[model samples]
Target: MEEEVENILQKGGELFHPGLSVDCVIFGFHDNQLKVLLLKMKHADKWALPGGFVYKEEEVEHAAVRVLQSRTGLGNIFLRQFHTFGSPSRSDRKLNRELLVSLDLEAHENHWFLQRFITVGYYALVNFSSAVPRPDATSEACAWWDLQDMPPLAMDHNHILQQALETLRKQLNDQPVGYNLLPEKFTMPELQRLYETILGKQLDRRNFQRKMLGYGILDRLEERKRGVAHKAPYLYSFNKEKYAAALQDGLQQGW
Candidate 1:
């Protein structure tokens, strides 16, 4: 697997491009906000996207799913094919040899720096409602960071995050995302927060409610959140199977 293909990029071989890997930027929403899952390297203290190399016998998408599961401890979530980034400069785009040296990976036996890598980026949607995240071998910790106040991430990860967000927004132009960030049941406020976070814009409360309900994709739960100041809000959940089917058609957002 360490065999170099030599001048691969120039001759359409794999060697010059180095080893190709896939990194996943998984996002989940909870408590009425959007959050990104991140892992901090042991020595660097700086966070990087969850990533792993494709096994010789494994599929690229499968490899990405495996990496996301390895780091976030959540699997079988809905993931989409977003984009592939291949810029030679992107290799040194975020962390470099110096950064990896600080991580002391040599001592940990994870000498990832020696090999050249080109990563394909994939973003997944996970339900924060029922997910428990954990750190993998290369990371000191795995935690959720709110997108609104995200710190400077390592490498082109900030670009990765932006790409994921843009993909999500484009999805929203036709369909509703952020369902993974919601609970099995949530209020309109929770739904609105998810949209606002992704679109980076506030919407009218009443109009938002009218539009969401009118879509007829939600299943009103029997119960409601209690003890606020005004009226108790009813709980709601998306008909995932049905909503998924609708994607084959089209979602009219009333323009």
Candidate 2:
């Protein structure tokens, strides 16, 4: 672990751009709740968003994709750049040095990782069951945390998360957003639950269904979901072509 940390720190100076990083708020939907992927630091009792430095040769967006893939083991995810955070105090050099010392690794005063970084904030929507989370070199555990029950996060991550969620909520008002966060086939109630979870409020069932159906982006299947105690609800799936078009063109209505 120490060697791996050393290698990453050394590589940061050689292969990554200085003073620039990418932090991703990877959102997932499962069990009718909204979740965000987070990492628990190895030697600290703190959680953080999945993030990393930008490689010198990589585009800022590609670097975000690489970071997300490394942490979540999923590719082709729905990713978006929402904002840039450049607060001078966002990075804490003293605490970073302490963490390295805890790992019994040398923390050089001039190390690139100790410098203040201006990070690009991105958010990704992925199917909860599809992702296999993996910790990075600095993190000991990688897992999902409910948005409302998140623990103390490191650095400016809590602020970053708030901004990401705000961006997601605002985007929900303008565009369609459930294709990647849900299974290929789902029920209307399931889809509505996902929206309600992100929006932090319940939508009127009839109105939500009418609005969704009116968008012309869903294909209702004739088959009903089986084995339910109550009357089975019909299954629905996104019409990929229309869904993609809706994503490109705004939904033109808000809840």
Candidate 3:
């Protein structure tokens, strides 16, 4: 594995733009909470957003997709590029020093990685139950972390996460991208909870139902939610045709 990584890095360094990379903020909704996929750095306590350098021939968006797929074992998901972080001080000297010490770096390789980096940030929404997180060469472990319970991250990742969430909040009112984070079948209450979790506020149940149903993108199923203490609500699924139409028409105002 080490030899393979060394070869890949050498090739990538030859063909890819140094000091420019892509970072993915993969968001998931589960257990009435919002979560983000984070990777534990190999031989270190620091965690970082799943990210990778952009190949010289690759478009930034494609690079983001590649990074996401490589780190999370997911492809063709709902991905959106929102921001770029290029602060000169964003470099993590400690992490870089540790990595340099760990790897048998050639002179050229050392020069390549020691410089400043600017990362184009992208965020993806995925069904938590469907996502299979995978660690990349730089990481030892990968797992879902509730947004509130996230551990300290490497570099400017914490800032990147905040920017990603803000972008997501803006998207909620415009794009119907939230469906990517949910199960196939869900109840109004569950749907509302998802919105509330993202928006970070309590929404009136009555008003929430009315606005969501009014979108005309949901198909009410005959089946009801089962095995709950409270009254089982009717199940609903996104009407793909109508959802597409509504996306073209845009949302009726705000949720």
Q: Judge candidate 2 against the unseen true structure and give its global Cα lDDT, from 0 to 1.
A: 0.89
lDDT of each: 0.72, 0.89, 0.84
Instruction: Give TM-scores for every candidate, taking all chains together and pairing residue i with residue i.
Output: 0.80, 0.94, 0.92
Kindly list the per-residue Cα lDDT of model 3 for residues 42-120, writing each as its tens digit. Answer: 8578899999888888898999999888776777788888998989899765566566567775534355666778999
Runs in model 3 deviating more than 4 A are 107-110, 246-249, 252-255
**Span of 10 residues, lowest total lDDT, candidate 1:** 1-10
- Candidate 3 accuracy as TM-score: 0.92
lDDT of 1 by residue, 1-255 (tens): 011211211232222233677888888876666788888876475888887667666678998888877666677777876888777667652344554444332322233444456788898889875667777655677888998888768768899889988998888867766566776778888888888877889999999888877777888889888777788888888988767765656576555
Highest TM-score against the true fold, candidate: 2
Check candidate 3 and list the clashing pairs: none
Candidate closer to the true structure by lDDT (higher is better), 1 or 2? 2
* Top lDDT model: 2
List where candidate 2 sits over 4 angstroms from the true fold: 103-106
